[model samples]
Target: MLLITGITGHTGGYFLKELINNKYEGAIRCIVRNTSNTSSIDNSRLNIEKVVGDLDDPEFINRIMVGVHTVMHIYNIHHSPMIVQAAIENKINRAILVHTTGIYSKFKYASEGYKIIEGKISELIKNPKCPTSITILRPTMIYGDLCDRNMSKFIKMVDKLRIMPVINGGRSLIQPVNARDLGVALFTVLMSQKETTGKVYDLSGEKPIKMIDVFKIITKELNLKTIYISVPLSIGVSLARILKILTLGKIDSIERVQRMGEDRSYSHNNATIDFGYNPMSFEKGIKIEVQEYLKKNRN
Candidate 1:
């Protein structure tokens, strides 16, 4: 049996579709939050057992690990240590874990817990007694659907306000992979377990675009006339500091603002050479996404 976590989520939903397309015959089990909506999986034709629980609970994880040979933990990267521990303890031989490209962030606050978790997972993998072979797939900013919270929010803001506040002259580079493309890459890695085992792949979009170009594309796709206001990086960080205090640390985005000046692009040549990974260009993917958003808003 194959165990999956977060199959009801955005990327997970697409990954499940890929599995269905490939005609995977394995018995699948998914761990969903108590409040999770499983209508998509429950209504699907795949043989899936829905296990209600939290990844935070080792007891629940251990219980679900039974009869499971492969694990796909896609819910959260912070929850990886426990999942990897459980995979090691349960003697599961093969697993695919989704982490993030934020692990490479230069900002301390942003990369906090990332290195520690990656290190812990690495140590677990190094254990001579460990039986699990783990593969880590890191994806850059994921933007496809409306719920993505990255590009869609930008689109909505551009539509509503017609003004975009960009920091650092909006020159920093970002590569955002479409959820559908990332899903296909996930399935490719799953099928090539022998080649992908113990390897890390960066599943990024086709290419990197400047932060300003991102907003430009959004304005064009949404057919909105927008004004771009460029704020200096220092000023942006100061505003974030004030917002952080005003929100009682709830909106603490000082590091996020600071990191905006840094480039976030990565090469995915390895993923391409290994898994035949081919991703759609941002304009093509975002056009379809924008159309969906426009249609829904019209309805």
Candidate 2:
């Protein structure tokens, strides 16, 4: 049986779909806190057993991991090392950890923003009780269904402002991987237990697109007559800082704007080679996202 946590989330939902699509002959159990909410899947092969408990609860881990072969951990909350550690303690042989790429390059940013995600991962990996072979997949900006935030916000902002701002020298790059592709990569990793144990895969899109160009595409898709204005990074940072202070730094929107002005490009050659990861093109991903947005907002 395959046990999945955070089944309501983007990658988790997609992973469930991928599993069903592949016709895996196994019981799929979703450990969800809210048993009242049923998944949108209509497949007989999918059996969701909602284990009602929080990740912070110690006793819930053992109860959920019982008789589970593989555990796909996709918790939205960053901390809570106990969740994974408990799985390890329960002797789940194969575990797949879904981490964000933000954890590597800027460790400080990752640690502060992510809050013990990578640290917890390392802790679980080194623990003696952790006999479970683990595969870590860190992805960059993800876009597609179940994504009500991030890129969708950009599109909404453009639709609202009727004009988009592109930071000066908007050549900073981004690789927004489609959610389905990420799901596919996760299933591929789980299905194959070869040389991936104790390794990390950077699952990114096929190509990186300029941040400004991304806004342009979003604007065009919304059929909005918008003008792109380039703002200096210094000014943008100051504004972001002020807004952050104003918002008390709770999910600051300005911080996201500041990041767009900075370059964030990397090679996913390792993931491609290791897991046969084939992420969809950024263009196609954006197109699908746009369609989904339009459909959601349609009258």
Candidate 3:
């Protein structure tokens, strides 16, 4: 049996589809919160058991780990310690844990916590007593459908604004992976335990594109008359900070705006070699995203 978590989330939906489309012949159990819409995991075609519980509860995770040989945890990386503990206790064969490349962020407050949590995970892997083979896959900014808030927010903003501000002239490089591509990497790693176990894979996009180019591509795809207004990095951050304060923290992420000037690209060559990980280009990806976004959001 395979136990999965976050199967109802953005990338989770894509991951579930991969398993079903490939006709994975195994008893599957998915851990989810009580309120999660299980429409993606609880359909008639798939025979997946939807086990509702809190992954934060070690007891809950431990209980479900039983009889489950392989575990695919697609949820919060912060909850990984307990999941790792549960996997060790149950003597699981292979555990696939999904993380983000955001761990490399230059943002002070966020990076500190991410590094600390990652440190704990690192300690688990190095510990001699632990036996479960764990593979950590770090995907860059994930965007495919509307469920992806990162790109979706920008898409919505483009629709609302006459002129979109290009921070630092969108010069800093970024490589974002599509949700389906990340899911495929996870499934491939899960199936190929020998090569991927005890390794960290940086699953980025097909190539890195300048941040300015991203908005330009969006404008092209949407066929909108949204003009570009260049905003200096410092000016952009200050405006974001001021808006956040005036909005009582509702317009948060001043740091996100600041970090827009910092490059956030990484190499996925190892992931490509190991599992034939082929990710779609951002140009092609944004085309699909615009279609999905327009269906629900456009007038």
Give the per-residue lDDT digits (tens) of candidate 1, residues 1-299. 99999898999999999988887888999988878888888777888999888788899899999999999989999889899898889999888999999989998877877889999899888977779999999999998999797889877887888667899789999999999998899888988998788899998999999999988898899888899999999999999999999999899788878989999999999999888999999999899889999999967
Q: What's the true lDDT of residue 61 in model 3?
A: 86
- What lDDT is reached at residue 80 by model 1? 91
TM-score of each: 0.97, 0.89, 0.95
Which stretches of candidate 1 lie above 4 Å from their native place?
none
TM-score for candidate 2: 0.89
* Model 3, position 239: C-alpha lDDT score: 90
Regions of model 3 farther than 4 Å from truth: none
List pairs with backbone clashes in candidate 1. Answer: none
lDDT of each: 0.90, 0.74, 0.86
What TM-score, to 2 decimals, does candidate 1 have?
A: 0.97
lDDT measured at residue 76 in model 3 versus the true structure, 0 to 100: 89
Locate the minimum summed-lDDT window of 10 residues in model 2: 35-44
List model 3 lDDT by residue over 9-56, tens digit each.
Answer: 998888888888788888899988878988767673766887988877
Error of 1 at 96 (Å): 0.7
lDDT for position 292 in model 1: 91
